[model samples]
Target: MGLRSFVTDILPTTLHTRGRHAPTLVGEPEVETFAQLVDKLGYLSREDLKQVRAAYKFADEAHLGQFRASGQPYITHPIAVAALVADWKLDAQAVMAALMHDSMEDCGVTKVELIERFGSPTAELVDGLTKLDKLQFSTREEGQAESFRKMLMAMSRDVRVILVKLADRLHNMRTMGAMAAHKRARIARETLDIYAPIAHRLGLNQLYRELQELAFSYVHPWRHAVLHKAITRARGYRRDIVERVRSDVDKAFGEARVKVEVSGREKTVFSIYRKMREKHAGFAQVTDIYGFRVVVQSWQECYLALGVLHQLYHPMPGRFKDYIAIPKPNGYQSLHTTLVNPLGTSVEFQIRTEEMHAIAETGIAAHWLYKVGTKSSANPAEVAQTLGAMWLKSLMDIQRETHDASEFLEHVKIDLVPDSVYVFTPQSKIMALPRGATPLDFAYAIHSRVGDHCVAARINGEPAALRAELKSGDVVEIITNPGSRPSPGWLNIVRTGRARSKIRHYLKNLEHEESQALGEQMLTQALRAEGMALPPESAPEGTSVWPTLLRWSGNRNPSELMLDIGLGRKVAAIVAKRLAQLMQEQGQRPDAVTLTLARYAAGGEEAGATPPSLVVVDGSEGTGVSLATCCRPIPGDEIQGYLGRGEGLVVHTGDCGVARRLSARDKELWIPVAWSEEPVRQFDTDVQVLLRNDKGTLARLAAAVASAEADIHHIDMGDEARGETAELRMRLSVRDRQHLADVLRTLKRSPSVLRASRVKPERPPG
Candidate 1:
């Protein structure tokens, strides 16, 4: 390995713009050179440096004559970015990517050109860093979010993408002062919101602090200036106390014969501002701002140093934390304590080993900075690798289930938040989840199947609702039922992106399948009316037939045409007539016997009722076909289907006035619908249960529903608790009409219930 890993004299800044007659990279007196960048790659072979230098030449040529806001050659910016990547001792491809990240976006250089120049991996990383300027978006924020999502997805596949992107961002931020005031504020806010949090999540403490301080300076310059003055004044007043404490600590450690390095740690202005806002306190109340970090040689010495410090000062109650025993999710390990010093002031201290200090400072970057020659007892690089790679792998899991860029970013942002709760599994295995995460999130984190089939949860072996928020140290056990499926409401309460994505994926697939089935049924009924038989789409003639039908209907594929028919976007009868013509042209003829049978099967036509196709709802149908909210139709209820445009077949209770209104306005869109005898899924229908005003009435009502084996999906009490009685309105999920009857019977049998009846849509609140 090169000696560059131990060198720390280099300065950090981003790429600079190019000038028309600027000095060459190596020839310039002040500009960063090829040698400077190559020197930081102590871990790489000479060939790697050669490839990195070649990339620099390419970027330098492409950015010729371009000048940044700082009036420097544009090539300098990428060179600085590459230099930072080299600081982490990233591979040659990563350095190449950093050098060319902006070439495609700002220099009109293409990804294809980059691939031919520096290979695919470098091109791919540069592509990830490229913004979405080519695509037109309705909003600027939306476009920005999409670009971030794209970058994160690429970063998930290769951790180096983020490493380079972060370096690029750091460089840009360092030179942000050259930009316009408004632009600077916007960039600073973004750095604070997105980049800073990411640095913290990656355990890049030095980068995190710099980004936060830079952002705070521009985001609230007035506040930052005021805090700076206050801190300077406080330092002057506290110098004597601080020095005395340092002296006492040094003397005590010397007596114990323990070799250690101690340094003064000061709180940043942003942290002070945040504390002021969160605690609603004045600056004077932030007593623990004065702190120190003690770096020892070994783990044993960390504990020994902690004991020495506690002996020197009275330790504050409940202010001790042993992170070395159980490291943070980011792989940060240290012993933290607060003590009352001789001056009656509280001072915080952090204790850790030198290796731990390296990991804490550089995070995953430490892997290359301090690579081992052989397998050691405990490797900080391996620890950071396990934790960082685990998080990166999870991004793939989330992306598999979430297709929308915005939604994917949303999930990732939720995961980036470090405020987490540690919950234990039934086996006592601990897992960290973002705070406010419910049992559904826990189930998904454990396994997607567990979340899909989760019916309930038990916290500390006591029955808990699935939506209950998990607390740290809670022993959570999710109960799974193979027959149970995720609920739409789960999306509202689940705190993790993984759970939300999985649920949405399952629902989307379910809806598509149901829509296809419904569309086929409608098209078949339409074909019968056209004096034709429905042909399989997979057949040779059928394949050609659909393309013809889709052409006439302005659809792209067979599934799209069916989905349109299912969603009432197109009249099935009209499409069927066109399809019949196409089939006839293909030399396929309609069968007389099948046509006659289908005509009879087409609902209520003989009795002069609307002769529309029928749709069967067995509760398993996804959102493709839904029971109308206005009607709340269920099994055993005579129903009619309304194919509203973009709304899959909507089943309405036959007597519904909304159905009548829709039929009057759109007669051709009406269809017949029925309920399956043994529907595998459950349907929610509302009911009003009148109960005598008494305690335990809700428990009794729940018991009755449970006894009938029906689940109460949701319930609402009246606006106010009335005098002698109260009405509990419940939306119950029942399997069939018989199941509904059983639930009503059970409710009526309860001693507390005065009356129980199905809630009609037209009924006014009483």
Candidate 2:
């Protein structure tokens, strides 16, 4: 078929549904069989065909009594999926997997059984396509997330897994009309949100557009029908214009002596709908609905054809793009330009070589197509690698860092956006990132180490913020320092799954380490209070302490025990008392002098025994020690520590009402904590200010706080403020009580200040 006829006829509608009255794929008046499927297997060897036929026969027998909602035999779905896979010219194993993809899910066929019949590779491919319905999940969303995670992990290992699964999903989406409205809508939404984007990311434009169209139709039948009618009427109205453009393009290419095939292209219904939604326009206002593709034999002819088209029509200014020099993230290459016709309508033209054309339509699947066709000089493996290797590897990387299925699914969705911006490294190496990606994302894209240690960035040879959005063609230089690590705040600005995962992983590990350290310190103090030293990790000749302690605590290791203590999962004093008892049984006695000193330091408990030493709050501990926001304790304030379950130690003021309420309940979880003599970090405290209503009054108050060497963390003003005075609430970070007092005095001296005082903690009466 001619290129124009191929695109206009076969490409627009690659998937379709058949009503109950319509004929099946095999034909009317005949049962569904492997005859049509076998016809598409010309690229496979005779041996491969025999294996595929065996799989088909086994699947048919397994599904003998099963029928679909449409009353067709269940085996037809597998056959149809296999035929679609074969159409992509995938290998025999992929075809076989497609033929039996549903066996494990529906017919109780196990992976081992398939492995015994087919090879391990074929069985694995089939297994990867199966859903996770056999496993119990708390929610449907969780189950679906895990199933996608499994399939994606398998696809990362072998690309054919996804090819077969996409075919399966495509076939399912095509026949979804037979399902109930709610089920069809749910599946259609999933296909549109996930499968279609994945198909586009893999460069299977043919399947991508078809899946989108079909999903949109099912998801919004009313809108679909109305748009379908509008598109049909528009096609009829513009038939003469399309023919005129085709003739003019052919004549121009002929006169220029460039060998090219010209074809007319129309946007899919989904794409048209998306454009309308994005532009917020009506159907009649949408322009450039029709386009043309010019396929050539070589890259040089592609440029020549572009020149001829630009000369034949008035090229729209700033509407041209050279994708040949910088292909899309999916490895699609073409030169795109919009030109104005004599009727003042805009029409887009895409010029590409035949190989580019194939890749454009089939994407990564074109690798296999080229391997069988001898259509291009490029190696199939290299083409596939270039097109999708990084993205596939990213899936595994994300899985490694993310364990929760829903979180993993969220990361995958973040990566699925098809739009991208291509930037450069300091060495001029090109890196393509999702649009709106920042310098931190670029750093992670280079290496996780780089992202973890990234301190600053320079874009286009000038200093730039790490969170600055990158642009195409900009050279990004990342500066790394050994002391610098990813901040929890970095998650707010990063735009890629890989960067987000890496940052979260780093923060989690850091939190674990800090928690272990805090737990160790607390345990040491508790042991000291008992007049005993913390046991060594292992003894030279005697029994080791950790194994017995871990066994008693039901922890895997000492660090885990410490983590439990640090996170309030276990109490340090209780564990220390138990350890002391175990040591005393082993004939170890406490020193008299140590007991006397500990008892004196602990204020000499009435029972003539030492209590656990007080925990010191220095404000330097990271996530392992946090101040309770309810009381906002500072260094000079009388404080106590509460071990919140699964959360690190929470420091609160001695008189905090929240602390009193909790003390009335689980009092043992609270620990005597004292402020360090010299804390290294500032603490946040709230202050209320009544000021005159004036424009620059707020600014003056801020300057007063800054003059006193305190920083305002946040400010709040009531919207009901009126008349002469306004109430302002501010959270300020100050060194201690003395520094805060200085800030309050400075603020009270201001002329606009009517009143200023520290906001007292709310203490509800019991």
Candidate with the greatest lDDT versus the true structure = 2
Give stretches of model 1 more than 4 Å off: 1-50, 135-142, 178-182, 280-282, 372-387, 550-557, 567-571, 589-591, 594-613, 618-620, 635-638, 644-647, 654-669, 676-766
Model 1 lowest lDDT segment of ten: 1-10
- Summed backbone clashes in each candidate are 11, 1
TM-score of 2: 0.90
What is candidate 2's CA lDDT for residue 732? 97
Candidate 2 off by > 4 Å: 1-32, 372-386, 523-554, 572-614, 694-699, 717-725
Q: Which lDDT tens digits does candidate 1 get at residues 1-766?
A: 1112101211112212211121111211332776777667777788987888788888989899999898988888888888888787777888899988898998899989888888888899899989999999888887988899889878766767888888887777777766877898898899888888888888887788777877777778777767767876787688778888888988898898988888777777778999999899999999977788899888998999999999999999989988787677777889999999899999999999877898788777776667522255665434445658767777788888787777877887778876778889999998888899999999999999999999989999999998898998899999999999877778898988778888888987777777777888888878887788787889888888877777778888888888878777788888888888988998878888877767666645676775443666787666887778886887788888888887777888887887887788899988877777677777889999889988888988899999999998899986984778987799998877788988999899999999998878663223
lDDT of 2: 0.84
Candidate 1 Cα lDDT to native: 0.80
- Which TM-score value belongs to model 1? 0.83
